[model samples]
Target: MKTLTIFTPAYNRAYCLGKCYESLLRQTNQEFIWLIIDDGSTDETGKLVDSWVKEQKIEIQYYYQENQGMHGAHNKAYQLIETDLNMCIDSDDYLADGAVEKIIHFWQKNGNKDVSGIIGLDADQHQRVIGTRMPAQIKRSTLFNLYNKYGVTGDKKLVYRTELTNKYPYPIFQDEKYVGLAFKYYKLDQEYEMLLLDEVLCHVEYLEDGSTHNMINQYRKNPKGFAFYRKELMKLPYAGQLFKFRQAIHFVSSSLMMRNQYFLKESPKKGLTLLAIPFGLLLYVYILFKSRTVKHV
Candidate 1:
């Protein structure tokens, strides 16, 4: 069996998905499986993937699901994955050359049951590292501490063990599509730290239609999902009180947007949630205003 499964959650990305596919074909190490989670694409993505599958170049698995947003697609991928390790390479992004080799050798040398997986780097189109590099001194850190305690910045690639990724299945809210992806990462942080691999693994380009580009619209439209995510973060035992308070602020904002009256009662930190009410109200108003003029990604 291959050591790693590189999964991509795609949503109508036929235009750029080929770039991701081409990058995989260029991999120096072919001991990885490419699993594409087709999140109900209306475009030519399925046909394109079929063409690649017909060529029989690399191992590929494609699963089609009704439009369930990114988190639902992720839930399905975790269920489908059987490899020892897996990491998401978004449809619009592609892996760096020899990244599979780097991860395999690094994990073979450094990995153990004690660690969750590897945390690698992501570069921009011009090959610049997307945020500050991982802290040089540390060999491993939880996803939360890497940013909050160590002052590391930017989006980093995360490779997780299949077992762990399967545990925290993100909830699909009634009509909402987004749940903060970090909810699962922070949950895993409570149990394990990820090995820091400083090499760039994937190159990312945030297109206009991507979720990162439309966070505010997502927040406005998916308040229940956001509220659920924020509440879970507030319960993290390893996280600092300040972090919990911040989550409470967002929880309050999302709850208000959803018109959930039991928000204070539902919060893990009721005191913090109460204190956050005024700020949350203001935030809700700001989001409502922003939604009037902005378009959803």
Candidate 2:
């Protein structure tokens, strides 16, 4: 069995997925399986993967589902992954030249049950590290602390254990197609600290057509999903008061958007949510104003 499963949750990205496929073929270590979750794309993505599957140049398992947003695709991927280790390489992203070799080599030498998985670097197409490299001094830490406590910034690559990833499933809200991916990571942070691998694993591209708030629109539309995600963060034992307050602020904003009168009662941090209400209202208003501005522009 392969040591790593590289899963891509694709939604109508047939145009760019070829690059990801080509990169996997270029891997220095061919010891990984590629799983593609086809999230109800009305594109030629399926036919494209079918052609590649016939070539047998690499292992590819493709599954199609009704459009479930990113988190829904993630839910399906976790269920289907058979490997002990897994990583999400976005449809618009691809592995670095020797990413598979680096991941397997480092994991085999250092991986254990106590650790969730490895946190690696992500670079752009130009090969510049996305945000900041992992702190060399810290050998292990939760994904939350890596950003909140250690001041690590930008996007990084995450390779998680299949067992742990499966434990926290992102809930599907009615008519809502989006949820923050960090929902699962923070849940796992409660029990595990990931091993740090400062090597670049995947290269990412942020397409202009990808988001709503910038995907800000995602928040305006998926209020239930956003409110649920923020409330969960408020309950994290490892997070700071300030962080929780910030989450509360967003929670209130999303809840108000939800038009759910029982938001305060449903909140995990009631007092904080109360304090955040005024600010949340302001944010809610700003989102409305900006959304109109976008439509006009």
Candidate 3:
């Protein structure tokens, strides 16, 4: 069986998908499959993958599906990948040279049934480290604690055991919103610890068209996305009401501080920041003013 399956959910990313394909072709080891989910691309992405399939001498499977969100494509990838280990490499992002070889070797050396998965570092398109390193040891980590305690950020840098991930497929919601896959991975942490590879294996590019860079408007307009995340967080075991309430405050406060429209949309509906109603809007406004002052100063 293939040891790894690397896939991307791409929509109209034909121009950039080649970079991902090229990186896979350069791998020092080839115990993997590249599955590209052509998430209803109207562009020539199908032709692009076909061309790459002809030129590249690796295991490549290109599957197309109706445009689901990124999480939807991920749901499909998890269902289709028949491998022990799997990862989702964004079409705009590519792996570091020989990074997979290193990851596979690390897994060979350290992982077993007891360990759930492996986490790696993320770097920007220019290969600069994007987030902090994984902790040397994570004691009592939950999904939120991974971010809150271990300081692990960025939804992209982790790899998972296919069996465990497939078991917990990302859920679809009533509207077009869902909790992030990172939350799902964190929930998995309740059962297993991820082996930290401490290496920058993927180069995450910030494309103008990419979801992270451009989805603010959609998320703002729909707003249900934020509700989806809040609901998921509250559902966690021991996600106590007090803790949830406190988290709700922090979340909206942070969003207001950042002027993230999604949270701005959420703040009123969920009454998330209004627990301290008299000063809540003032606090948000103050934060915004302070940020602007700091930036200008």
Per-candidate TM equals 0.98, 0.98, 0.79
List the candidate numbers ranked by lDDT, top first: 1, 2, 3
Q: By lDDT, is 2 or 3 better?
A: 2
Model 1: how far residue 175 lies from native, Å: 1.1
lDDT of 1 by residue, 68-151 (tens): 999999999999999999999998899999999999999999999999999999999999999999888999999999999999
* C-alpha root-mean-square deviation, each candidate: 1.2, 1.0, 5.8
Tell me the lDDT of candidate 3. 0.72
RMSD after Cα superposition, model 1? 1.2
Residue 225, model 1: lDDT of 95
lDDT of 3 by residue, 1-297 (tens): 889989889989988888888899889999999999988899999998898789769988999998777888988898898999998899899988988898899889888888677778789867678767666775324445667656677744777889888766676655563346666775787688667676888998888767665444344433345545554564566455665665465456445434566654554336544563334455456655655554475
Model 2 misses residue 40 by how many Å? 0.2
Q: Is candidate 1 or candidate 2 better by lDDT?
A: 1
Model 2 segments more than 4 A misplaced: none
lDDT tens digits by residue: candidate 2, 186-273? 9999999999999999998998667522566787889999988999999998888999999999998898888989999998888999
Off by over 4 Å in 3: 136-143, 152-156, 174-179, 238-243, 246-297
> Superposing every Cα of model 3 onto the true structure, what RMSD results?
5.8
